[model samples]
Target: MIRRHMFMSALAATVALSGCGGGDKSTATPTPTATPTPTPTASPTYTAFPLAAAAEFNTYSAAISYTGDPATSAVTLGAASTETLSTRVRLATDTAVATGTYVMRENTEESRFCVPTGQTCTSTLVTPSAVGNPEFVFRTNDATTAGKFSQVEYLNNVVKDTSSNVPALVLNRVSYASWWRGDSTAGQKRLAYTAWGYSTVYTDMPATGTVNYSTLTVTGRLVSTVGTTTAINKVTGTVTMATNFATGVVDMTLTLSTIPTGGGAPVAYGTFTAQGAIPVGQNQWTGSFVTGSPLSGTLAGGFFGSQAEQVGTVFSATGTFGGAQQRLIGVVVGKK
Candidate 1:
C-alpha cells in the first residue's frame, strides 16, 4: 500500500508540472503577422475643351449691337456697329480673366472706337460642358461706355455671340499664325512667323460678275525648329480660284515654287499641285495633293473670313513632308 501511494503521488506531481509547463526550457517566439498593403484610390477625371493642337492663346472676333440704348437704351437690329476682340485664354483650361483689344465700328458711320485708347476690358471662361464647350463672359469699362457686357458660348471653332442685341452673333476662332498678320508693329512683324510658319494665297472675286483668272500670289515662310536649330524658308506659290455663282461651287488650285533647303541638309522637297472645292457661301475649303517623285505626301487646309475681305483673311494648312512621314502645319493671312 505504501509503494502504490508513493507512485500515485509522483504521477500527480508530474501531471501538475506538465500542466504548469515547467519542463520547457524556453517559450517559442510568436510568428509576426504581415501588414496588408492598401489599395490605391483613383484620381478624379476632369473634362476639358477639345483643342486641335497645342497653342499658347485662343483668339476670337465678336460682332456686338446695343439694343436697349446706345446712349440711354435704344434697341436696334443692325449693329449700330461691330467689333473684333482678342484675349489671351488657354485652350482647355478655365481662365479667370483674359484681356486684349477691340476695334469697334458704329453703324452708319465711318468712325471707329478702339480700346487701349485709355480703356480696359476683361473676360472669363466658365466650366466646360460635357461635350467640351465652354461658356464665357466679357465686360469692359470706359468713360464713354459703362457696364458693357457680352456672353459667349464656344462650340468647336465657333462661338455664339450673345452680346448682340439682334440674332446672336457668330464668331470663329482664328489660328494664332493667322491672327499675327494684323500686327503692324515692326517687332510684331519680325516675330509673326516665330511661333509657326504659314503660306497664304488669296484673291478677291467680284460680288457679281465673271470670275477673273488672276494669278493669286502665295507668300510667307515655312518655319521649323529641331533642338536648338531653327529654320525659316521663304514660301512662294500661286493659287487660282474658279467660282460658279450659279452652281454655288468654287474650285481652287495651288502650285508651290521650288522649296528651299534650310535647318539642315536639303530635304528632297518636291513640287505638287492641289485642287479643292468650296461652296459659295462657305469659307472652309479642303483637298488633297500628291508630290512628284522622290517625295510624296498630302496637303489640306481651310480659310477664315470672307474671301472678299482685302485683309484679315486667314488660312491654315497641314501637310506631311519627306518619305519619313514628317508632319507640318502653318497659317497665312491675306496681303491684298
Candidate 2:
C-alpha cells in the first residue's frame, strides 16, 4: 500500500509540472534579417583645360536646341533637330580666356560680335559681318565663369599632345549653347548652337604595325534635349579598342544618371553599349547601339592626341521615360 501511494504522488507531481508550463517550449516570432541599403558610387573628378593661343577645336558632333518656330519672326532661335554640322574654330588671343578679348575665327570666315571678353551679350538682330556667315553672340549662363559667357569648357586633361608645348583643344569639351542670327538664303533667322565633341588638328597619327592597345574608360555628361528644353546629367563608362590597329574595332559601354540639382545622391538613368570600326589612316569611327539594348542610339568617335593617346565619342539615344519618349546626346573622352 505504501509503494502504491508513493507512485501516485510522483505521477501527480509530473502532471502538475506539465500543467504549470515547466519544461515546456514556447514558439516565438523570430526577428527578420534586415535588407541593407546600397551605397551610391561617387562622381569622378576632372580638370578644366583653359583656352590657349592657337588653340583649335574641330567639332565632331553637335546638337542644336532652340525656342519657337524657326520660320517666323516670333522665333528667337531655330532648332537643328536633324542636321549635324562640323565647324573648325580657333581663338587668336594670348591672354586668359576668362578675361581676354579674342578674335574668334571659324574655318576661313570670321563671325563677329563686339561683346566684351567673357561677357554675355544681347543685341538687336544684327547683320552678319560676312554676307553669308552666321554671327554668334556669347550668351551662355554658366556660373563657372562668374556668370560670364564662355564658348567652351575643356576638362580631364582632355587635350593631349601637350608635350609639344601647344595645347590644342580636343575631346571632353563642353560647349554651351549660344545665340546666333544669320541671313540664310531663305531669310533672316535666329539660332542657338551647341557642340558635343571636338578634337585638335591632328599633326600626326599612329603608324601601322603590330600595335597593342589598352582599355580606356571615359567620363562626361549625358545631355538630353526635348524640343526647346535641355537637361544634362553625369555619365561614365568603358571603351574598348582593338588589341591591334589592323582590326580597328571599338566598343563602348556607358551608364547615364539623373543628378539632383539640390545636391544629393545621383539616381541611375540607364546603361548602354555601342560597337564600331575605325577606318584605316582615319581618326573617326561610326557605329550603332547593340541590338536589344534598353535604348536605341548611334555612336561616332575619333582618336585624339599626337600619338592617338586619347579617344572620344558622341552619342544620341532615345528611350521611353515618364510615359514619354526622350532623346539623349552626350560626349565622352578618355586617355591611353
Instruction: Report the C-alpha lDDT of model 1 over 1-336, residue by residue, as the tens digit.
Output: 999999999999999999888996888899999999999754332222133233233222212111222232222222211112223211221211222232222122211112232344333333322323222322222233343333222222222222122111122322222111111211111111111111112333333543433524343344333333334454555566554434544444445543565344333333444444544544333443444422222222333333332112222233334322222222222222
Q: Model 2, residue 100: what's the lDDT?
A: 36
Model 2 residue 93 CA deviation (Å) reads 7.9
Q: Which regions of candidate 1 deviate over 4 angstroms?
A: 1-210, 213-215, 223-232, 257-270, 280-325, 328-336
Alpha carbon lDDT at 235, candidate 2: 48
- For lDDT, the strongest prediction is 2
> How do the predictions measure up, each by TM-score?
0.30, 0.50
User: Pick by TM-score: which candidate is best?
Assistant: 2
Task: State the lDDT of candidate 2 residue by residue for 116-222, as single tens digits.
Answer: 44455432223212212212223333333332232322232322222112122223333322223334323332322233334323345554543323444443443
131 Cα displacement, candidate 2 (Å): 41
* Model 2 weakest lDDT span, ten residues long: 128-137
